[model samples]
Every structure is written in C-alpha cells, then in structure tokens.
Target: MTAFHTDDPQPKPFRVADRLREAREAAGQQQKALAALLAWDPAKLSKTESGTRTAITEADVRAWADATGMSDEDRDETLEILAHFKVNEKSWRDRMRHGRRSVQLQYNELYRKSVRFRIFQTVWVPGILQTPGYARQVFTDLNELDPDTPRDVEADIRTRMARRDHLYDSNKSFEVILTEAVIRTLLVEPPTMLAQLVRLEDLLDLPNVRLGIIPQGRRVRTAPQSSFVMYDDLAIVEGFVIDNPYQGAQAERFAALMERFWADAVEGPEARQLLRQAITDLPK
Candidate 1:
C-alpha cells in the first residue's frame, strides 16, 4: 500500500515493458521484427511493450532475452524484476478463476504440512483463527467483489474452517500478532465480530499459540507494511494490490522485522483483557 503502487494500467518504470523495450532497441529490432523473431504475434509483442498484457510469462521474458542476445547478468536482473512486477499490479481476486474453495484446499495442505507459522495481521483475523461466522462474511464480501468468478461461500467457509484442524497439533506452533483494529474493524456484523473476539480470548489458553495484540494507541517507529505469514522461512505477504510470496533474504527480513511488532505487542493477560474489552464495547 506504499506510494509505489497504482491501480491504473499504466506500467511503472524499470518493469517488464521498459526492460523489453530497452533490450529490443539495443538489439536494433523493432516490435514487429522482434515478434517475428520470437514467433509471437505482432500484437502480443505490442501489448507486452505497451504494458497492456495482463501477464508477462516466463517464456515471454526468456524468449525476448534469448532473441535479443541479452547478457546473462542483465537477463537475470530483468527476470528478477519480472518476478516482482508480475504480482505487484494485481489484486488477490485475479487468481480466483477456479474459486476460493480451491485456494482454501491448497492453504489447508500448506497449514497441515508446515510445523511453525508466524503471522502479522493488520486487518481482519488471520485465516486459521477465524470462526465460521466470521469466515462466511469474509468470503461473501470477497466473492461479491468478483462477479465473474463462480461463487460458493458455503464451500469456501467449510474449507477454511477445516484449516483449523491442524491448530490442535502440539508439534506445530502459531505465533500471531494482531493490531487492535483487527477486532475493531466492522468487516462483518456486530455479532460475528463479537464471536471472533470471544474466540481470540479462548485462544489465549492454547499452548502452541503465542497471541500478541498491538494496541492502536501504542507508539511505534517505522510502520508495519502488510499482513504476512511466515510458513517457516517463506514469507507470504498480503497487501492492498499484492498477494505475493518472498523467500531467502527477503523472507528473512520480513521475519526479523516482525519482531518489532512483537516487541510493541501486549500478550498473555493483556491480550485477553483487550479482547474482553472489545467484546464489552461491542454493539449489543
């Protein structure tokens, strides 16, 4: 949600199109000539260069690099940029062609396989922590956003609620941090939010979970960027226009920075107290 993001279709600098344009120009090939060289339609190359193509595939990048005789170093660098920019311009809904239930099953597998999870949520409750009522509303709202996609909120809710099964495993851990605004957000109905808060209170007794709640009024230095889940070393970041995964140094950095939020967080009894207060303050 930083200033670098834009909803408009206009491509950003140093992205795929700019890099492709630079390489093609350096190789003395115009759009039509390059398209013929790569056996691609001229319009495909044009749309790619104009940033109108919704997706720039890996094959497209590699073919362009190979055709232009790009240096290995420059090709690698451009590939990295391609990787980052691909997901940078789209919402999470773009991936839901099959529907939310499909993704939920995929996540259920991930949750089952991973032994440790470190989560930082800035908005609604984390998926594993959501109750049936809360999850239903969440799926409904998101599904409504994409009318073209096949809608099945009940199936999505069932699949999502099933993900909670792994929570009881003593070998696995769920280290989660939530901002005060999570429970405060009226993304769902009053009763549903109230139920979610009550569920948070119960999670306090869970031996494997270490719940931390960052009070809204708490002073902090750098702002937390996005909601992210670290399934071991991998960081899956959720942003306004991004639903991307990071690994290696990038993922490590996300995990390290999460410590700051944990440091500012109030846990144990304090977290329970906040949840109860939110419940008490709820619309009755």
Candidate 2:
C-alpha cells in the first residue's frame, strides 16, 4: 500500500477525542463531574475521550457542549468537528422523504463539482451512462424493493438524464469499471437494455470517459462487495440503509484497491465486443 499523504496526519478517532478532552479541560470540568452533570456513566465519557467508542452520535456532542458550558460560537465549532464522524454516512430513506428527485439533484451537484470520477459497479449499469428509458426502469425496480424510494420516478429519471451531460465536459474525466454480471443482469426489457448497451458504446467515443468490463467466468483477484464512486479523494459507497463516504486513509485505500480492480478488467475494443455480445444475447 502506498503512503497516502494529507496535510494533516492525525486520524479522525483521535481528532474527535482530543477535541472533547480539550473542551472539558478548558471549561475547568473534571471527567466525572461533567459525566454526572450530563447523567452519563463516567466510563462512557472515558471511552469517548479515549477513542474507544464504536460510534458517537450528534446528540452526544451537543450534550457535551452544553455540559462544558461551551459558548454558542464554541458549540457550533464543536458540532462541526462532530460532523466529521457522521457526514459521510447518510440514510437513503431520510434523503428520499422529499422525493428521489431531490437525491438525484444532489448527485447532479456532486457530479458537476468533481473533476475526476472512479466508478465501479457489480450490478446494474453505471448511473451517469444510463439512458433515460433505462434509468426510469432502474429507479422503478429499486422502488419496488425499497418502500422508502420516492414516488417521483419519472422526475428522478429526468434529473439523471441531465447528469449525463457531464460526460461530455472536457475538463472532467471518468473511469468506470463493471463486472460482466452487470451486463448479464436484466433490469429492463430486452429493447431498453439493448438501447443502454448502445449508449455505452456511444459514451466510449467521448474523450473524457474510459469504461472497462470484467469478463464473465474469468478468475479475478479483486472482489468488490458493492458499487462505489470515488470522486477525487472521497469514496462514496452504497450501504444497505445509507450512503457511506470514506475520507483520508480509508478513502485512499479503497481508491487504490479500485485501481487494481480496474486493471483486471478488459477495456477498449474488447470491452465493446463484450457489450455487443451481451446485446446479441438479449431476447428478440
């Protein structure tokens, strides 16, 4: 593993813990005294400050701020530090309350801001490359399985279609890797799937895009559990309940591993041939 360098070398666990200890000491409150005032076990406070806790909630930080007599300005800053721990993981159900279109719009913003993107998928077509017809079916199928998926499937599809324009932006570059199984999966009818495959071929002609396909029945070294997108330094992974973003070392490690996964795949004309073959296999 290469050493991933950042301007700051300290890990997140230590950063959060040290900040809490500093806040308490600066407020002239002992651990036990603060714990008593907050009605929390001393051990819980110890674990949090010692960086032993598995997870820390936003409420925990707010309560600590109040107990420490943190000023309004200091409280806001403390909460911002707390946000580092949870900013990466956002619940899809929570995001979809307004509707899936809102989530798609968020993606559009992310897409527009990123200069480079590394996308890997084990199932379904890549979102930015999907045709409107195919994107609608993909959203519809996801809605069937996830009751929380918003009802605005058509509007969501339109938003997704708008995202495709980014593929032509010369200032940006996209490297996409897909397992052969993605081609084998039938999310829509044969005709729609065929159109998507054709779209993939058209996208290949774009100067900024590089797409690769890992052949079926071929032994490969890399095993990816889920689809993820690495936009610059951040790795956005799809979780069962939420989207998990990794930062610093964690993001660097995944980004390196994805490069290895991309290497095991076929690209250029061979990848195009695989797509054509998959299209041919579809029902007439």
* All candidates: TM-score: 0.70, 0.67
What C-alpha lDDT does candidate 2 achieve relative to the native structure? 0.78
Q: What is the Å distance of residue 212 in model 1 from its true position?
A: 0.4
- When superposed on Cα atoms, how far off is each prediction in RMSD? 8.8, 9.8
lDDT of 2 by residue, 1-284 (tens): 12222221122455678878889999999999999998999999999998777378778888888888777787777677666545432333355667777767767888888888999988878789898888888887777766755588878888898988888889999999998888878979889999989988887788889999989888888776688888777777763334556778988988888889987899899999999999999998
lDDT, residue 125, candidate 2: 87
> Which candidate number has the best TM-score?
1
Highest-scoring model, lDDT: 1
Q: Positional deviation of 182 in candidate 2, in angstroms?
A: 0.8
List model 1 lDDT by residue over 1-284, tens digit each: 11112322222323778888889999998888898999989998898887767578888889899999888888888888877665544544454656777667766777877888999999979999999999888777776655666888898998999888788899999999998899888888899888898888989999999999989886975486689998877677774323566778988999887888888899998999899989888888
Angstrom error of the Cα, residue 210, model 1: value is 0.3
